[model samples]
Target: MKNILLACSAGMSTSLLVSKMKEAAEEKGMEVNIWAVSQDKAPSEMEKADVLLIGPQMRFMKAKFSKTAEEVGIPLDVIDPVAYGRVDGEAVLNKALELMGE
Candidate 1:
């Protein structure tokens, strides 16, 4: 199972997207553990994640977290603003899968 971690300002904004992503994953028969955490909690959570997706609003934190993600050997990227604004879970999930070279 792939562990997908999303980091935002408060961890609340991504909850809906998380649900949608879960739905998309289920439809695709993919087994994944996805969760969101506040930026402050992300570093601790990264170790358990297979990939890290940062919320558009928290894009600045990417630089800060890149090193840790690199050390963990996971892909890290900012969510597409358009997809994020529309809460397009499938697109985001595809992006994550693409990043993982799936």
Candidate 2:
């Protein structure tokens, strides 16, 4: 199963996205573990993340996340704000796969 970790300001907004992504994964019979967390919790969350997805609002952290993800061999990218706001799970999932070079 692919494990994806999403980070946002307080994790509240991203949590909604997690639900949507989970639904999309289920519909496609994709075995995935998607979840959301605050930026501060990311380091610890890395243990289970196959990919690290950041919210647009936290774009400033991309470099940092990238460096950390690189050290751990996990792919990382920012979620498109429009896609995120719309909770477009297919798009988000595709984005994740793209970042992972899948």
Candidate 3:
């Protein structure tokens, strides 16, 4: 199973996104471990994440997250604004896969 890490300012909004992504994975019969955390906790959680997705509001932190992900050899990206705003789990999931070169 692939492990996906989502980060946001406070983790609250991304938590909702996590649920949606989880549901999307379930519907597609994909086995994936997904979790959401605050930006501050992201670096610590990087080792366990196959992919790192950042929320739009926290997009400015992409460079920082990218550096951490690079150290861990993990793929990282910013979730699309439209998809995130509408909670488009499948779209985001696809984006994650693309980033991972899956």
Candidate 4:
């Protein structure tokens, strides 16, 4: 299963998005492990993920997260505000897969 992790300022906001992404993956018959975490907890859990996604609120930290992702050997991307605002899980999931070169 692909492990996709979403990081947000507090982790609460992304919980809903995680649900949406999970649903989307299920619809496409994709087996994926998706979860959300507060930015503070990300680095510690980074190694467990196949891909990392940062929420818009924490967009400014992309540079930092990018470096960490590289060190951990995972693709990291910021979720598109438009897709995120609408909770478009499929779009985000596709982006993660694309970043993973799948």
Please give the range of 10 consecutive residues that has the lowest summed lDDT in model 2. 93-102
lDDT of 4 by residue, 1-102 (tens): 999999999999999889999999999999999999999999878899999999998999899888889999998988999999999988999998998898
Compared with the true structure, all predictions reach lDDT values of 0.95, 0.88, 0.92, 0.92
Q: Is candidate 1 or candidate 4 better by TM-score?
A: 1
Error of 4 at 4 (Å): 0.2
Using TM-score as the measure, the top candidate is 1
* Clash count per candidate: 0, 0, 0, 0
* Model 4 worst lDDT run, 10 consecutive residues: 61-70
Tens digits of per-residue lDDT for model 1 on 1-98?
99999999999999999999999999999999999999999999999999999999998899999999999889999999999999999999999999
Model 2 Cα displacement at 69 (Å)? 0.6
Q: Which regions of candidate 2 deviate over 4 angstroms? A: none
Report the C-alpha lDDT of model 2 over 1-102, residue by residue, as the tens digit: 889999998989888788888888899888988999999998789778889999999999999887788888898888999999898988898888777777
lDDT of 3 by residue, 20-96 (tens): 88999999899999999999999999999999999999989999888889999998988999999999998998899
